[model samples]
Target: MRVLFSVSSWPTHYSSMVPLGWALQAAGHELRVLCMPSQTAAVAGAGLPPVPVLGGVEVAVHNRLSYVREARAGQWPYPWTPLHPVTGAAMSTLDEFDLGDYLRTDGARFAAASAAGHDTAVEFAREWRPDLVVHDPVSTEGLLAALVAGVPAVLALWGPVGTHEPAPVRILPDDLGDSFPRHGFGPFGPDLIRHVLDPCPAAVAAPVRGQRLPVRYVPYNGPGVPPGRLPRTPGRPRVCVTWSTALSTMTGPHSYALPAIVAALTSLGVETVLTATREDAEALGPVPATVRLLERCPLYALLPDCDAVIHHGGAGSAMTAMVTGTPQLAITFASEQSRLAERIASSGAGRHLPGHIATVETIQAAVAALLQDVAYQRDAAALRRAALDRPSPVDLLPALEKLAAE
Candidate 1:
């Protein structure tokens, strides 16, 4: 079978689909991952064949978030009337949603991702004629490509099924005005996806809606050599402190919070390993002499030896700790991230504080609680078992095949 995988340039997003993509490839299916050129090297590093698509998600998302900031300032990014951009996609005009703020933020995000590679992937799908196309929920271009090619398209959700559903937004590029009729399809939305794959463990995940299918959350931090043997200090409770690699790209209110968190952790006599890219590591200001600051390492490789974790609430980082059964403290920023932190706290596996409100005292308190609280440890361990008990990608292969066959 021919399968095309579409994802945004984000590494964490791409990592979510790696295990499933491998399952299909191992089953003898012809697979090619479609991503922007910025993500090409990382995709190749993951040992997956990457096909470059046209426009880049970087330009798209950057502009979209700028639009969000404008909207928050009470400035309208779009004119009273919509303008025909080069892609001929509508700007500022949006459909009715539960929140008007959502229309500008998530709406812009989806449209940007859709606009970036829509035409390129569609042309490729039309020519290559794949039997199936699987895509990240945030990157909806694959659906357009599948629609154009008249192939089955499935959604591979990156996080909680409920949290990751594609926002209902119309990204109808001007060039594709009459394309739907030609492709024999109507409007596409989250509800239109007949088969949706979810990897969140049931213990922490909300109830699945629609035709959602469950798969085990196999954690992958992408290609990197193991960080040799960990020389964990004797008799010290090790705490992994990270802003994640994604933080290097993040321009958030809490960007400087890491150094404070690190200082507090080390002052408490806990060994703190601060992980991030060199650039992000430098951004953390002065690191305490006691903290071991590593600018790079696969988080999964580091979590196994740790007793607790402190992180900005990137889904990949939080989920990695959860799967490894390590208790955590999440400094959640954006509203979307705040929900994940809340969910973890509700599950009894971790504690979370709002990023903007997290001071040295708060971070120290949260980290200390996770390290000292036995309930958090017990609960995280149980959740890890729940994830392990869920079906693996190999077990999910038959269902994916059945979906494609249908």
Candidate 2:
């Protein structure tokens, strides 16, 4: 079988699909990744062939314009406020909006920006004639390509929210009407999503959707070598601190509280390992010698030895820490992130702090709790076991093959 995977330009999103891609390849099936030019290197680094479709600059411009338009329309909110308190059972406004907007627009802003690429992907799918296409929710182009090619399309969710909720009626964009007529798929809808490969464990998973398929969460933080000269084992309790590479771009410079977080961790006398990009590191300026700063280091490599992790609540970071059995202190600024952080806290595996309220004192207190509390460690280990008990990517191969054959 030939399998094609499509993803957004974001590295984190693409990384989530790598293990599945690897599983397919290992089964002697052919695989290719359809991505923007900017993501080609990341795809190739993972040893997958990249089929570059859209112009990177064009996509980037559209993305920026969307942000600008949303900001101008006052749709952009800072430090997402939850409808219910962190540990509450009530549904959040964010979830309601995301599901409603996603079904209505199918991510209209991004879809519109990548409309041309959607055509290109359809063309590629026709030429390549893959049996199956697997894609993340945001990469609607993959679904379109598969629909046009009469192949099965699988939705690979990066987190808990997407497939769990009841999908609303899909409102296809007028602009995309012409593209679908040739294939006779008049309008896209939730029914078109034949399968949903979810990586979240049942313990933290959202309410069910019929097509949901549980896949074990695998940690892939991109290709990187472990830093040399670091201690084999820390003499003290070691804590890892990190922020998403995309957060600063989306939320502005004010979102970067690495300096304060680092200071707080160091004050607790715990060994601090700060992972960041070169630009983020420079922005951080000088830090105390006690804090170890690593540039673009893979969290999967460093997280195993750490007792606890403090992060911006990215799905990759949260899953990496969870799979490693490391306690977490997630300081989230967005709704989706807050949901994940809340799950961590409620599960007894960690704690959540909203970015707005994540002062130095709160951060220090959370880290101290993660280190000193035995319950956190015990719960983290339990979560790790639950995650491992789920079917792995390779284990899903038979089902995917069956779907493709059908």
Listed per model in order, the count of residue pairs whose N, CA or C atoms clash below 3 Å is 0, 0
For every candidate, C-alpha RMSD to the true structure in Å: 6.7, 7.0
Give the lowest summed-lDDT range of ten residues in model 2: 166-175
Q: On residues 7-49, what C-alpha lDDT tens digit does candidate 1 reach at each position? A: 8767786587898888888999899988878888988887789
**Looking at model 2, how many pairs of residues clash?**
0
TM-score each candidate.
Answer: 0.81, 0.83
Please report, in order, the local distance difference test score of every candidate based on alpha carbons: 0.69, 0.75
Clashing pairs in 2: none
Task: Report the CA-based lDDT of candidate 1 relative to the real structure.
Answer: 0.69
User: Alpha carbon lDDT of residue 354, candidate 2?
Assistant: 81
